[model samples]
Target: MNLTTKVNVTEEAEKLEKVLFSQKFWIDLGTTSLRIVLILIFAVLAVKIGKVIIRRLFRLKLKGPIRKSERRENTLLKLLENTISYVVYFSAILAVLTEFDIDVKGLLAGAGVLGLAVGFGAQSLVKDVITGFFILFEDQFSVGDYVKIGIAEGYVEEIGLRTTKIKSFTGEIYILPNGSIIQVVNYSLENSLAIVDVSIPFDVEVNRTEKLIEYYLTIVSQDKADFINKPKLIGAHDFTETEMIVRIIAETKPMRHYDCARLIGIGLKDYLEKEGITIPYPNLVTKSLTDV
Candidate 1:
């Protein structure tokens, strides 16, 4: 309303408008955005290139006469890939912060102090790291190994500094912290046993049944590459009121027992059908009320 107040308000509006329309403001924003984008791009490229390099290095090592264990190499490759990703992304974040005019040195110093203060309370984290180290060092289990830790049973997908990844047969992934893995049952370290039970009606001649199975066992492993040796017929294992159970044992490559067992069951069923040896099935009969 007053002349002096109107002039002051107009001056403040003009100054605000000028600042908003300044070329330097838009230019600075664009520059900072472009720098951040470039930093992120470089980080992604670094991770990809690092992974390729590591895989190539492993390939070269495998080609050598004195080669390392493939399982162990796979574990190391995964660990290295994760490490490179973490480092590259962390560096990229720092570069982006610098673009925003954040003091990198001061932030890092403060983080260091904070980390130290928090370390005492982060016992599980420390334990996880230490346990992971010992696991790798002792070669308890490697990536691709079939293992059971606690209730999680599957192939090891990755072993990291703080956690282990297990991919189950059902497509579920279990992420277990390293500190909690107290007992591990690794099935990949040795051969596996596959047991198949064939049930025959008690009326069938036991000697003839055994002979047929013996002949079948001789050729069972011939087509199966995973089988370490021919399957053996362990003879009549048990007897039921209607049928007799014969057992067959197979020695197969580690983690391949499942396939081998299934193949054995199918082949034996087919063989018995072709030989006219009928597997018993319960018979049902219905009587009319007049007959009863």
Candidate 2:
């Protein structure tokens, strides 16, 4: 090669080597990586600390005499925890972008415009948020409530700003958008009724059956703390050719009716058997095909 060409090539190689082997460049890269790692760690710690604080604050409120509804407080606690996580992670991402020498302000500005444009097409999302806010404000339902929304019946697992989560008894989870919940039937808001029906032979006197049921209900009320008051024996709710139906109704704590009803049925059955009253059971008689 010519001398001038060789000199130019050597100068380019030296410049490339200097750029690659520079200690300052490696130090700056390491520093930037460390800062990004620290930023992420700080974000994670902030979320955890924020959650802890929220839980402690709610616990303190529960200890006070003028405490608010526990369900509402639990819902709010979860919402705040989620919000803190989202905000911290978002900030951490932006901080990391900044460390990479990207202009965060310009990115955010562009994002804002894009978000606005996207908002026009996301009407259902906006509706969901607005409806969720009203659901909280109006106290329609809260976490742990047994509710029926539309065709879904389950316990509320979470109430978020955009959606609600319900866990059914069969272990199915239903995630519903807030805007679609047109009606809600909350079974947890009031006491439940435990109704038990006892059928007796027509030969038994109605007055005697009523007296026995009344005594049995009084005993049940005394034994069980779930009963709000003594159960009433409503005489002769129905009648058939061979049997008379007697209805007993008890007021119980919410969601306690099913178990309470079963308990009452068991106790009453035992009591009636001891008193010589027999419950009738269907008798099946089978005949051979030839006999038929």
| Model 2 stretches astray by more than 4 angstroms | 1-13, 21-27, 129-144, 154-175, 197-208, 222-226, 233-247, 276-292
List RMSD in Å for every model shown. 10.6, 8.8
Writing each residue's lDDT as its tens digit, candidate 2 over 1-292 gives 9999999999999999998899998999899999989999999999999999999988988998898777777767777888899999999999999998999999999999998988899989999999998898678898888888987888999988899999999999999999999999888877878777788888877677678878888888896778888877777777788898777777778777777787888888888778877765312122111222
Clashing pairs in 2: none
TM-score of each: 0.60, 0.72
Estimate every model's Cα lDDT from 0 to 1. Answer: 0.83, 0.82
Q: Check candidate 1 and list the clashing pairs.
A: none
lDDT against true structure, model 2: 0.82
